[model samples]
Target: MSSTLYAAGRAARQSGDLQGLIDAVPYARFLGIRSAAPESSALLQLPFREGLVGNPALPAIHGGVTAAFMENAALLCLLLRLDVLRMPKSVDFAIDYLRSGRPLTLYADAEISRVGSRVAHVSVRCWQDQVQQPIALARGHFLLEPAPESA
Candidate 1:
């Protein structure tokens, strides 16, 4: 993480603000990803825009954008739950496109499947209208910063 992002992350940690963290990431800002208020559920939203449409015929959000959104959700989840200053790096991510993503405000929530000493596993589900009917699902592995050892 750059010094600016590090500082932003630290400030967000202290104040429980997600926008600072999100704004620090350039790609997140370009994609227009935003989180619900901290008091609300940990749901990330990708608002609809003409630029995000991949297929004019289908009028669907690009597959890459969908995948990136899920990955962002997972990363943000880890950041919120982990006790580290530096952001985690993605090891690998696998995604399943269940259906064509309609050009609408998409929402995603990530579940932390497991957290080991240096690795965290996360799964994300994305939907527009119904949670039960997800448009995509993704699982990602992340490399976390090592925990400091006590003397």
Candidate 2:
């Protein structure tokens, strides 16, 4: 990731393309996660691919992948909301698997429950077709560091 991408994220209100920020992250790019705008809301979308399947028999996406996706979503949400450009470090993370993620497009939305000077708390939910029936849910605390002052 680069500072240029963080600049893009800060400019998203004008450009309306948050996907650039998401794509800047290497893991998100590897997972084929992109940003989707449905109506007036932005969401993280994970497309179905063969390589993401952890169980060939059941053909389900790996649990770790889902967790990582949720965590990334939370991070992206925080990045977009902050005024400064800096990467957040995960202080703690907890996830609950509601159902197996089948071979289908998954979408996630993150909510920032609380934000302090040095820490932020977020909750994320992932679902296939309906948001009400989430396949996985995650909550995490992230350390937010201020950007170095320009010299």
Candidate 3:
């Protein structure tokens, strides 16, 4: 992990700094993903970019990019809720593409179904304008480990 991420994670752990947590991930930065603490849930935003389009004819965002965004959103949600500042490793990830993602700002939110001693399960949904109309849905299992004391 980058030192910048470490510091940002630390700051996020202490305060409810959603942006700090999002900035911790290099890929999140590249995707222009933003985090927000909504009244009810944690929300993730993905800004539209021409480079993200997979098919020029359809002008749709890549399925892989959408999946990655959903996964990262889940991880960020877990990090915010976790007591320890450690990186969670994905054990398994599954995504369902409901509809084609058009060239627009996308949003996502994660629901952590369960958290065991060593594993956590999360469900994520991504939408363009309305939450009812989702573009993709994802479920992921992650390995949770305690942070080193030396940190």
**Comparing candidate 2 with candidate 3, which one achieves the higher TM-score?**
2
Which ranges of candidate 3 are over 4 A from the true structure? Answer: 2-7, 37-41, 148-151
Q: Which ten residues in a row have the lowest lDDT in candidate 1?
A: 142-151
Best by lDDT: 1
Alpha-carbon lDDT, every model: 0.84, 0.83, 0.83
On residues 1-151, what C-alpha lDDT tens digit does candidate 2 reach at each position?
A: 5476567567764566777777777787788888878322458899988888999899899998899889989988887776546778899999999999999988999999998989999999999989999999999999987555670
Model 3 agreement with the true structure over 1-151: per-residue lDDT tens digits: 6456556666776776678778778778888888655432469899899988999899899998898899999888887776445678899999999999999988999989999988999999999989999999999999987556787
Maximum-TM-score candidate:
2
Give, for candidate 2, the lowest lDDT window spanning 10 residues.
33-42
The alpha-carbon deviation from the true structure for residue 13 of candidate 2, after best TM-score superposition, in angstroms, is 3.6
List all candidate RMSDs to the true structure. Answer: 2.4, 2.2, 2.4
- Between candidates 1 and 2, the lDDT winner: 1
Q: By TM-score, how accurate is candidate 3?
A: 0.88
Q: Which ten residues in a row have the lowest lDDT in candidate 3?
A: 33-42
The per-prediction tally of clashing pairs is 0, 0, 0
